[model samples]
Structure formats: C-alpha cells, structure tokens
Target: MPHTKDELPDVLYSAAQVRALDASLIAAGTAGFELMQRAARATWRALVRQWPTANELSVLVGHGNNAGDGYLVAVLAQRAGWSVRVLAVGDPQRLQGDAASAHAEAVSEQVLIEPWTAQSGLRGIVLDALLGTGLSGDVRDPYVSAIAAINASGLPVAAVDIPSGLCADTGRILGDAVHADLTVTFIGLKVGLFTGDAADVTGELVFNDLQADPQLLNGTAFTARRLCIANLPRLVSRAPASHKGKFGHVLLIGGDRGYGGAILLSAQSALRSGAGMVSLSTRPEHVSPALSRIPEAMVLGTSSANQLMGLLEKVSVLVVGPGLGQAGWGRSLLSTAANAPLPQVWDADALNLLAGGQVDLPKGCVITPHPGEAARLLGVSTADVQSDRPAAAHALSKKYTAVVVLKGAGSLIAHPDGRLALCHQGHPAMATAGLGDVLAGLLGALLAQGMEPFDAACLAVWLHANAGEQQGKLGRGLAASDLIPAIRQLLEEQAPCLK
Candidate 1:
C-alpha cells in the first residue's frame, strides 16, 4: 500500500470493520475513553497545525463517539486559552460511557456548552462532528437545521473522522452532508472519502493511524486497495536484440464514419505505450485519416465481420469500442471480436453495445464504463450505480466474469475473484471525451505485453490519471491526445525498461 503525506491508508475499511477495530482496541486493554481522548488530541493537533492563529472554535457535537471526539477537542482548545464553544445537537443526557466522560471533561475545562438554535452566530473554524459513519437514513430535526447553518456560515470546517451525513461505506450523501475544508480521519481509511460526492465534499484529507497494532490491522479484511504507481505491475525488460514480434500485437476495433479521432487516439496511445504492433479496424471512411494521423498503426478499412477475421488472428490483444457506432457495421465487427480467444479490453460504445445485448463479452476481458454505461450493464438506473460505485463495479465484474473498471471521480477496478482497487489521482479535467479510449488502449497495450486483465486495468487507470494530473496543472484545453505522450513519460519514469 502506497502512503503519501496527504493520502490515507491504501486499505479502506467499511463502517462495520472500523467499529470492529475500535472494539478490538478496547478489548486489547485500552479503555474506550482513552481512545476517545487520543482521537481528540490528534484532531486538536491537526486543527492547530491547520489554523495556528485561529483562537475561536465552534464544535458541533452529536450523540456518538464522533461527538465525543469533538467535545474533547473543545476541552483541549479551551485549556489552551482559546475561546471554544460546543453546540450539543443531540440530547447530552443520553451520551453514555466514553461520550459521557468526554462531556464531563468539556464542562470541567470551562468550555461553553449550548443548544443549537437557528439564530446562533456560528463564527470561527467549525468542527463538523455530527453524524459519522453509523448513520443509515436521512438526517432529522435540529441536526438538519444545524447542518444547514454550518453550510451557510461560509467558514472553513474541520471534520472529525468521516464527515457527517456522508456514508462511510459508500460515498453517498444521506439527505445532507457537511462540506468540510479539511477532514481528519483516524485508524484505517474509509472507501467513501475518495469516490462519488465524497471527492467533492472531502476537501483536503489527512490521516492519523492513532498508533494501532499493525498485526491486528494486517489480520482484517479491506474493502479495496488504492491504486498507485507503486502497486502497478510493470512490463518485463526486453533484451537488446528483441524484435517487434517479442512485444505482442494489439488490435483496436472502432471508429464509425464521423468518429475517427477516437480510434486514432487509442492506436496512438497503444503505440506510444510500448505495444510492439498496433492495428485498427474501422469504417472505410476513417482508414485514410487514421493512417494520416498515426502511420505506425496498420490501419484496415473493414466494413463487415468477414473483413475482421484476418486481423483478429494476428493480434494478441483486442481493444474494442472507442467510437464504435450502434450501426450494423459496428455490430458485425464486435460480434467477430467476441469470439476471439485473445485477451480483450472493452470500453465506450462496446459497453453500450453489450448493455443493449448486441453481443456477449469474451472471457478474460476488461470492461471500462462510466456511471451511465455501468447502469446499462447492470440493468439499473445511473443513480443506483453512482450511489454505490464499489458494489456496482463488483457486480459488473461478477456478471460478465471479466475485470470491470467503473470510471468516475474515484475510478474503481474490480475483478471476478472479489478483489478491488481504486484510483483517486485524477483531476476534473479528465472528464473529457476520448479519455476513456486512451485508457482502453493503454490497458490493451499492457495486456498485449502479458499483464493479466485485472493488473492491466489497475495500472492503466493510474497511469492515465497521472498523465491527466500533469496536464491539468496547465489549466483547461486538455485534449485526449495530450495524455498519450504524458503517459509514455510517466511509465518510463515510474518503471523504466532496462534494455
């Protein structure tokens, strides 16, 4: 697992797993109150580091351990001579065990505890310690009003652990959620913090392990591992005397009448990313332009399934669907590829075609789909797919018995064996058209070079996102073609070929 200064644990845990960890800590001779205090002290240190000069604090306390963490943070702030106030949103009388002790500590420290009111003039850095990971339904009552007030304040907020009203299991926002400027999470990272709306809501993420037992963590199950360059499999170093035949061939099947650029981008990406031989089977009208754009690729003008048979036999890997239309020509070509014994990468229109039941997917293939395409594949609405992207990706992989890449904010790659990985390195600029094609081609190139479908998909997503991040720094006007050269540079930088 790769750990950056600003990144959380690569191993993501669900709400239940996190609770079990917390319970295990208590069972391992550490008192629950002591653990709560440690969380508070950690949050306090983060708060002071983030805003050293701010002397005012407004802590929003709910009824759980999350609220206990906030109360202790308020006490720490008050003891340090800072003006700290706690708005107890939940009934303080109901707080039990660690939470009850934390409340007493706050009172003993002379921190002002007040009830949440509509007219409360919330100033200073607000601490959103309201709902946490255990919430299942819509936020009710004064808590809703308090959440609304916090959003309207326009003040920077520091969320303790997970943000309130955001599902820690899925990235779904339950009715309403706090949009924090910085969220400090403890123990293991949660999957919700990196995908869907969580990406937008969780501004700058900071993680604190709280000195938990590494042996205990190693023994537990994780939801997914975060994708990074360190985790990707590299192509084997080629010998100096190696020929073109040694690198394997990739056949790109796509490009309808007016969509030649899509297939051209995929071929270019594959060629640049170290595929030994690249071929394109597209509409007759696209062949000339594709050849003109990338002379390295063996462009074929094929309009029927019969024309694709010869090309299919020569290639080791197939990357289908970039700009494949829903016309009979596209269907014929796809049908032929479906029967090929080679490893395959399916993306864009190919996914759309599969969703429409045009053809069955080849075994040991990879399917990359955005939320809409994912919905089509699962026979559900787009909302259902986005609501639980990890579940959707896993379902797609199992249903097709192939690797599935669910592309969105935090792109997820899932395998049929119940293994999953996520890439949270991309920028918003990567949401442009033809980017998916570039990714498919990159994955195809990896597969041709002898990587398994799951490993290739994970590596391709990380490399593509890293390239997008590099170009994203230059601002807008980033084209899909811009990522190819960037990806080539990144691949060499991360995993140099020692020929």
Candidate 2:
C-alpha cells in the first residue's frame, strides 16, 4: 500500500486474507484499535484531498470496522472546522471493541449522529461505511436501501475500504453496490477492486498499508498479482546484426470471406510487434487484399487442410481464429493447426469451434476468450463467468492445458500451473472489433520470438492494453488498426531493440 523502498507491492489479497493480515499485525504487538485509527486517518486524508472545498460531510455508519472508520473520519472533519453528520444505519449499540470506541469518540466530539431513515437528508460528500468484506450473501433490508439511496443521492461518495454489497473475493455485485466516486483501501490491495463489476463501481482507487510491517505481507499468499509496467516481463535487447531468421516466423490462419480484415489485422499486428516474418493463410478471395494491406507478410490462399500443412511446418507460431468462420474451411485449417507442434494463439471463432468440441487445442498454446466465449467453452452462462473471472480463467487454463487469456474489462492471463496475472490497463475504446485478433497476433509474435507461453501472453496483453489506453485519449471511433502503430512504439519503449 505505502511505497516501500525496493519493494513493488503487486500482490492482491482476498477479503479473508486481509483479515488474516489484520490479525497477524495485531498478534505482532500492533493493537487492533491502532490499526483502526490508522485506517480512519488514511481515509480522512484521502477524503479531504478529494473534497477540500466541501465544508460538510455525511458519514454512513454500519456495525463493522468500516463504520468505525467513518466515525473517526467524522471526528476528524468536525475538528477541522467542517460540519459533519453520522447517519447510523446499524445501531451504534451493536458495535463492539474498536468500532464501539470509535463511536464513543465521535459522540464525545459531538459529531451530529442520527439514525438513518429512508428520507434522511443526504447532503455533502457521502462516506460509504455501511458494509465490509465480511458480507457473503445478498445485501438485505436497511443497508440495501441505504446503498441505493446513496447511489441516487448524486453526492460524491467515498467508500471506506471497499464499496458495500460488492463481493471482495469475486468482484461480483450482490443485489447492488454503492457507486463510489472514490475508494480508499487499506492493508493489502483487494483483487476485487480491479476486476468485473468492481471496475464500474470503484472510482479512483487509493491504498494505504496503515504502515504495517512489509515483511509480514511477504509471508502471506496473494490471490493474484496485479500486472503493471514495473513487474511486467520484458524482452532483452536485440543485437545490431540480428536478422529475420533470428526471430521466428508467425503464421496467421483465418479470414473466411467477409472476415478478411481480421486475419489482415492479425498478420499486420504480428509483423509490427517484432515477428521476423508473418504469413497469412486465408480464402483465395482475401489473398489480394491481404498482400496489398501488409506487403511485408507473405499471403497464401489456402482451400484445404493440406495446403495449411506446409505453412504450419514452416512457422514457429500459429495464430488461429481471427474472423475464422465456423464453416468447413475454417474447421479444416483449425484442425491442421491443432496437430502442429508449433506454439499457437487462438481467438474469435476458433474459441467457438473449440467450444463445439470439434478441434483439440494444442499443448502450450495461448487461448484468448472474452466472457461470452469463456461461458460457452465452460458450458456456463456469461453471468457465471463474470461472477468469478479469476476462477474462470484458471478453469480454462487447466481444461485446455494452455495459457488462457480471459479478455474483458480486466483481462486475466492464467497459466495451467495456477499462476495468474491480472491486467488492469486498457481503455473503453478497446471494446471495438478486431482487437482480439490483434492481440492474438501480438501474442504469437512474442511466442515466436522465443518467449515462454505465459510470459509472452502477459507481455502481449500489457502492451496491447497500454497501447489502447494511450490511443483512447483521442476519444472514440478507435479502429483496431490504430493500436498497431501505438503498440509498435510502446514495444520499442518497453522492450528496446538496442543494447
């Protein structure tokens, strides 16, 4: 949470794990009350910085330590000459230990405390302290109504720790969740904050350790590591005399009529992302356009599975599924690629074809599937996939014995051995068409360049997402091709070609 020298805090903790950490710190001589006070102080600092001009504050208090944080924040604001009110949704008498102490401190400070009602005056910036990570079921009664009211109040809400009603372990919204304008988290980073519905509800995320001992956290196991530029895998510098043969050739197969652009985008992306050579095998009708679009790539028009055999043998990596129709031709190509020993990247209709149980995915390949494709492959609904994306990603990786890229708001790259990486980058503009095709190609290029399957997937996903983030600032109508140039530039910056 707090930046410690020489340590990049990338571990993501679950709700239960954070509690274990709290207990660990407490057992190690730090009092629970001390941690509570620290959490409150961190929240106060963040709230004041965000709403410095607001002279009034409304703190929604529940029965947990989350509410205790709200109470202490109210005390801080009241002492700072800001008018503060505490709306106690859960009875203050129900609070125990540190939370009760916090409530008593607020009362001593004469912070205006009142029972929450449906018509409670919702004024000033709202502090959502109604729920905590302990919640496991759907929110019921007063809390649900309060969360709904807070959402409708149009007030800038600052959620303490995490937004109420959001699953801390899975990032799923239970019934509903408070849409906070800002959320200040403590102890360790919760995996929920960056994935699934949490991304929509959690505004700007702020973290603090309450300054807990860094060594204590090292002993704890994390749910997943949040992928950032600092911890991302990087490619080593290439020699000046490096030639085309040094980097592996990537053969892209797909583009059944009307989907020619998909394969072209993949081929072009592979070429631009440092693949030594790129080959496109598609319908005969798409040959001219593929050649015209990316003159650097060898365009081959293949009609049957046999034609793909030679191409498959010549390439080090194979990218399948970009605009690959579910017809016989696409099936034939996918079938051929499935048998090849080359490293593979599969997306689009290829995922659908795999879901249909027609083709076997090759070992040590990478499969990128959005939630919809993931659900079909897992024989579940999209809602089920979204409910627990990390689990879904791990499931896919083990099921296929390949690296799995679960593409969505927060893309997850999962290895068959249970290692998982979450990419919290990318922009809304990247929700356009043909991006997955580009990603598959880029991933293939990395694999072809001799990066391991998991490392290549992680690097490619980060590069793809970061490129979209940079290009998305231009606003809207972002085509898939716009990302290729940006990705090329970013790759040079992230993984320089020179020593």
Candidate 3:
C-alpha cells in the first residue's frame, strides 16, 4: 500500500508518449547516447542504494535500447569495482545506433559478457534489461526461459526502465514477466506499472527524469494523471451560517431480500462522508436493522416501484445498485430511478442489469465497475478487459457518456470529456466485499455536496483507497465498514469543513 513512487510525477504516459518525449529531448540537443549514459548512471545510483552490500552484478540484455541501458550499467558497475557479467539474451550484434555503441563500450571496458543459456549462473543483484516497452505480443523464445530463471533464482533483482515483458501501455504481462525487487525506470512513469498484473511483478518502483528539462517534461502529451492530494478535487469550506439543508440530500437504493448489508454500508458511508441527509429504500425486512444501525438516515421499506417515486423526488443524488438483485421488485425500482434524471452512481447489480440492456445508463452520471462487471458491460471476456484496462475504461466512458470508475489495483477514473486519472493508492487486504458499495456511496456524498461527477469520483477513489491502505496496515480481515471512519478522517484532512 505504501506508494514508493509518490514523489515522482502526477502525470502518467503511454509507452509511445514516453518515446515521443524521449525523441523531443534528443531533438532538443541532448544526444541519444548521452541520454543513455545518463539513464545508466541513474540506474547505477539506484542499484547501489537498493543493495549496498552486493558487489556482484549480473545483467540480462535484450536487443532493444533497454539492453543498451543494461550494457552501460555493466560498464559503470565494472568501474565501481563490482564484479559484472552481461547475459546476452538478445544478440549484441543486433544492437543499433546508440545501443551498438553501448555494446562496444562494454567490450572496451573489459566487462565479462557471455550468451545466456538456461543453466547460466546468475550472481549478485540481477539486472533485468531483457525487453523494453515496444513489446506488443506475448513473450517468446530464450527470453521466456530467461525470465523463468530470474523468477526462480530468488536473488535480488533490479530492472532498467521497466521489467522485461511488461507492456508499458497496458499493465498486462506478455505471456510472462520478470519479477524484480527494485525497478529503476527512467524519464516518465508508465501507466502499466500501476494496474492489472502490474502490482504482482513490479516491486519497488523508482523514477529518474534523466535530467530532462522541466519544460520538455511538462510539454509532452500523457495518457492519464496520477491522483494525489495535491491534484485531488477539494470541497469548499462551509460558511459559519451553513445549514444541513444547504448541502444536497443523497438517496441510496439497494438491498434485496437477503442482501441488506451492502446497501447499509453505502448509506453509512454516505452519512459519515458529509451528505446533508441520507436515505435508504430497501425491502421491509431490512427496515428494523437499517434504523437500528443508521438512525440518522431515513429508512423506507420499499416493495414496489411506486414506493420509490415519492422518495426519488426528494433526494438530490442517487446511489443505485448495492446488492440490488434482478428480481421484479428491484427491476421496478431501478427503472424508476433510471428515469428520475438525478446524478446517479451505479454499481454491483445495477451494472449487471445495465449490461443486460434492461435500462440505459443516464448520461453524465458515474458508473463504478470492477473488471468482471466491466467485461459484462462491454460485452467482452474479463481477460479482454484486464488486458487493456485503460482502453476499457475509455470505451465505457465514451459509450455511456458517464464518469467511469474502473476499480482495481490501479483504479482509473475516466471522464466523458477524455480526462483520465489513476489512483495508485490501495492495499491488498482491500480485496474483500462491500468496498465498492462504500465507494459508490462516498462518491454520491461528494456529488451531493456539489462536486462534479469526475471530481467527486477522483476524490472519493483517492480517499477510499488511501483509507484502505491505512487500515490494511493492521493486516488481513479488513471489513468494509473499517474504511468509513478512516475515509471521514481523510476527507477532513484533505478538505476541512471549517477552513
């Protein structure tokens, strides 16, 4: 949950965007080889800092410029009195331009170099320079065996730029990927490093701008911006004469016959996150428990679509579908809510129902969908959704004209306006149930308080993920309710009520 690269940049780039940034730097008078050498020096500095006691270096090189960085790291390691060896996974003779020059420099420095065999003895801290960002297909051949060996070695490892076999554009692992202990990435941070199967393989992340001019870094195009405290949307401080009615009222609809807890969690989160008033419309059986748990919220036992008509008119925001089953009663309520023209937050069964084409998603609302739910909505397999999450999020945003919160390790918030933001904050312990419900309600609360859909989602995701990270430190068995208090505290810290 600890963000190793939080000190880096808020901007995230696709593989091609970073390449263009690199090209612009070269075109601006910084020689390509000079940039490579700077990258090597940055990697060398990070390697020594990560494993100070290790004096041996075993570097794996591919045919790309990534290999060029690795070869240069070998030369720097040799000069620093470390035993260094380069395992040529990609033929050194195939190196071009700056990469070929890097190979020749390695040879001139008397660095020990050899072809990589399956039996190659990897010594010291292994440096994975095997593959670079251009990889578009599944891993192949000697590199596969090499990656397998690296994973099997159990030695401390560092990757130059990115871990070999990790798609810089998407976080998908191409067939296989190297698991590194420390990944020293140069220039810009790749969006792939935070999402999908990325967290499993990308260990400690470190970024170096390689001394690129600040103007150049700011001028390039990027895929998404990282959501952090500095860039998160803030709510206006309340006036001293402010009243509860001044803030918007929030209505959370869900909780079928047997699934009442999910909706309660959402309502509870909404109540605590500063909604002026919170309401719950659920089955008659849940009325007593809802009132007993959240006496602050107005709980109504709703059995038919007509029961929600009056309540829908009174609420300012709607949080739909937390445990909303697809039964006739639930469907009736959803159909009613769908036509209310309120700023809605759809999750869980609501998304499933939407995917079933039973109701159209309201424009400009927010839809929070996990990968499986996203696949259903997109009419594709979950694998397809995970393979390229950014694309899926973008597609959903465009299709529904809604603010889409694609929830996962690297949660993405995509706006209909083409603005995308990623939240890298979260804990592994947060993989439990009811979390999405909590997020949906929190987002609704933010919206009720007058934040725009995209702004509310970005802030809600950041707060929820950071709260999960904080509570997750207590270690496993993190309940969905555990995040509510933490989120309230974080919201106060982010945007104080008085000031």
Local accuracy by lDDT, each model: 0.88, 0.90, 0.93
Q: Rank the candidates by lDDT, best first.
A: 3, 2, 1
Clashes of 2: 0
* lDDT tens digits, residue span 181-216, model 1: 888898888998888888778877888877889998
Minimal lDDT window, size 10, model 1: 1-10
Top candidate when judged by lDDT against the true structure = 3
Better of 2 and 3 by lDDT: 3
Q: Over 4 Å off in model 1, which ranges? A: 1-7
Name every residue pair that clashes in candidate 3.
Answer: none
- Poorest 10 consecutive residues of model 2 by lDDT? 1-10
Q: After superposition, how far is residue 305 of candidate 2 from its true place, in Å?
A: 1.0
Q: Which residue runs of candidate 3 sit more than 4 Å off their true CA positions?
A: none
Candidate 2 accuracy as TM-score: 0.98
- Pairs that clash in candidate 1: none
1-499, model 2: which lDDT tens digit per residue? 1111223368898999999999999999999888988999999898888888988899998999998999999999999998889999999999999999999999999999999999998999999999999888999989989998999999999999999998988889999999998888999988888788887898888889998899999999889988877888988889998999989999999999889899999999999999999998999999988878889999898989898876776888899999889999999889988999888899999999999999998888899999999999999999999999999999999999989999988789999899999877777877799898889999989988889999999999989988998898898999999999999999999889997
TM-score (all chains, Cα) for each model: 0.98, 0.98, 0.99
